[model samples]
Target: MLRYLSIIFCAATSFSIAAQGVVTLDSCRAMALGNNKEIKTAELKIKQAGYQRKEAAAAYLPSVDFEGAYTYNQKNLSLVDKDQLLPVKTFNPLTQNYEYELLVNPSTGQPVIVNGTPVPLQMALLPKDALTFNTHNVFAGAITVTQPIYMGGKIKAMNEITHFAQDLAISMHDSKVEDVIYNVDAAYWQVVSLKAKQRLAEGYVSLVESLDNDVKALVEQGVATRTTLLSVDVKLNEAQIALTKVNDGLVLSRMLLAQVCGMPINDQFTLADEDKETLAETTLRPATFNMDNVYAKRHDIHSLELAVKIFDQKAKVARSEMLPTIAAVGAYHAMNPNTYNGFANKFGFAFSVGAMVKIPIWHWGGLSNKYKAAVTEARMKQVELDDVREKVQLQVNQASFKYQEAYKTYDMTCKNLRVAEENLRMAQVAFKEGVSTSDEVLKAQTAWLAANSEKIDAEINVRLCDVYLSKVMGELKIY
Candidate 1:
């Protein structure tokens, strides 16, 4: 019972969430831009680049650190006096007497004196005590200010690279948005077109059903032959089949729309009447396009430019490794030893500032190799930029040509639809006046339906090609 209640509660919450959302083309685009996984991932990369840029900017600022350490060390100190081992002599300058003194003679077993005075000979032995140290914790805090005196332009170059990376991220995001907008427009319009086709098919089927009833009634009245009734039956069957096909197509189109909206296919949805009309009238001719402008403004091109900048900066950073980096440093420390200072804290502090230069003397060709690779990558990006520009030009040209063709087809189809309508009307009146045969009327009706189908197809193409052209021109969202 509790599990069922929990399921019911979840279901209610989901329904409430879904009820708040209204699906429109603009709304769908906004939702996809905000919530689509791909777009969201791209946005996250942009954020990451932003943080990296911030980190690069922060490099120019001062830094502070708090450090603490606990040390337990033991040491012993010993010293020997070498002066005691050497022989001692006494000299009297006034008496001019010089003599050596010995307390005992090994062979004579007697003391020897110099200058009528005996001096005792002795050796002194001393022991220096060993020092033991206990654990001593040292806590110190220092505010270190690192003002970049010079970095051989490496820091500034890196910051520029990071800024370029941020720009690249933004461009990538725009590229993804363009792609999503195009895809969604395709799906949304496809579903709308399919729905219109389905309605047309249903209308044809209804007309066939009415004709079938008339044929049956005529056959019963002995005015229509069995062959004529059979013909009408065949037409009815064809119309039913066409309707079935269109219904299936509608279902599929709805599924695709759901996919674009990032919703479940099981969700029930339909296009608004105004949306259907608006989609039918979509055109791209008003959008301005120039191959040169497109090449200059393409997001992909901008992204590549940023990539080249980053690679160039990478080369600069590598070159910086070969130059000397100078820094000034100062330190202070305290010591405590049991034997030396009776386990008392001896504190000391020192302050000094000096420049240091570290010259790179030799490497196993590592720096050279890295610099070479960076240069190669930067060069490759330049070639890639050209290739992408060519491709973008081709896309724009192709889309423009296709749009023109679709427009022509739409115009021709409109004229053909009017002719088919007149032909169908003339055939119906002639059959009613007992001049044209049922077969002729049936043929005219078939022609009219086919013409209508062609017009619908042409219109669909016109709208789709317009979307394609708009996308190529980078104006999918703008218009």
Candidate 2:
């Protein structure tokens, strides 16, 4: 028995140590923003867009390129060089003939062919077609730079478009942050709601246990039947079962809250009691925001507006494709034929600067099709902007109506809780005076528990819906 007591004491101590940490509302919000996967992804996208916008803005700057190459060539120079060929006379190793064929033979009708004798073969005329000019090996290097002289304002338009896109990315990041905030709020409120229900369940169990004791006392004094005492015991058992269910629900609610706050599942945390009290006292109401004003102010709406602007700039870039691209180019080079020679004797430098303008004479209507596509996409984005406006207004209206409905429900439930408490008090008094049955007292207790549960749910929904409505109006951060 002493060993068992020591084990129990150690377990209690461990539990207390594990459950010591607490999380406040502000801390939860900060951790969610820092650790939530969705928010982290949004921040990364914003950073990527920032770099892309910088790249687009840097398009007006000059660009420089360095190139080097080596080549080898072995071929004839020109067709007019006739003395470049050489002839030879050799022994008759294959045909055994000192043979010669001449067009103008003086002593015979055919060219003379003397077998096994020395012969003189004159230099033959070389084939004039096998010649080239630029045939020697050469190595060249050059550094060229080009600046955007004019691009029909396409570069500037693209820069403007990416600037707007960066703003849209930032707006999207803001929306993700808001979503994280809403999740934390809802999860924390759920935990609070379940805790309240658990308290009510425990209270019901206690009341039923007390009634069971009283009925047992009356039975011992010959004032109550055994059947009545048994009924009271059954009610006590049912209350205990309800209390167990509530405890399980509270544990599950706490786990959910931890998940939303991006904490480890095994990590124990207690929510701030003051925060729950403040949430219970907060009023539910719609913010004063006009639909027209919201369409201009909300990040989601503004992101789409910026999208339309980007498409407009894209259309300009597409139109610029029909015009010519002009730029100046210059280069210098050196050539050498000897393998051992360096840049001294075998070096020659040449430089020429010129403006090149390439005009597209015709295509199979490719340029026209691209320009049409750009125009179509731009108009489609315009329609999308209008759609976003309609959607935003609908969401705002729905959230506002829900806020009002929840507020009214919360108010009614508060009044009902008071009535339930009074009813339970009167039923207890009547039972003590021999004017109420055990069933009547049990019914009143059940009603009070239900009323308490409903009030807790209604109160939580009011605060939750208020946060939702504020998120819709983009006023959550202000709160």
Q: Write the per-residue lDDT of candidate 2 for residues 118-154, one digit (tens) a residue.
A: 2334656556554434446566776776777678668
Residue pairs with colliding backbones in model 2 are 76-132
Supply the global lDDT for candidate 2: 0.75
Q: Score candidate 2 by TM-score against the native.
A: 0.80
Give the residue spans of candidate 1 off by over 4 A. Answer: 1-23, 71-126, 130-148, 273-289, 332-352
Clashing pairs in 1: none
1-479: candidate 1 lDDT, tens digit per residue: 24224434543443444456535565555444544688668878888989999999887765544455555435332344232334456675876886554588778888877888665464333333323223344333333444555665678888989899988987887888788877877787677777777777887888677777877887899988999989988998999898898889878877876777677877775454314533446544843466776766667777887888888888888888777766554433333332234554554443444565667778998877887888888889888878887888888888889898888888898899899999988987887777877788788889889888888888878977987787777766621
lDDT of each: 0.71, 0.75
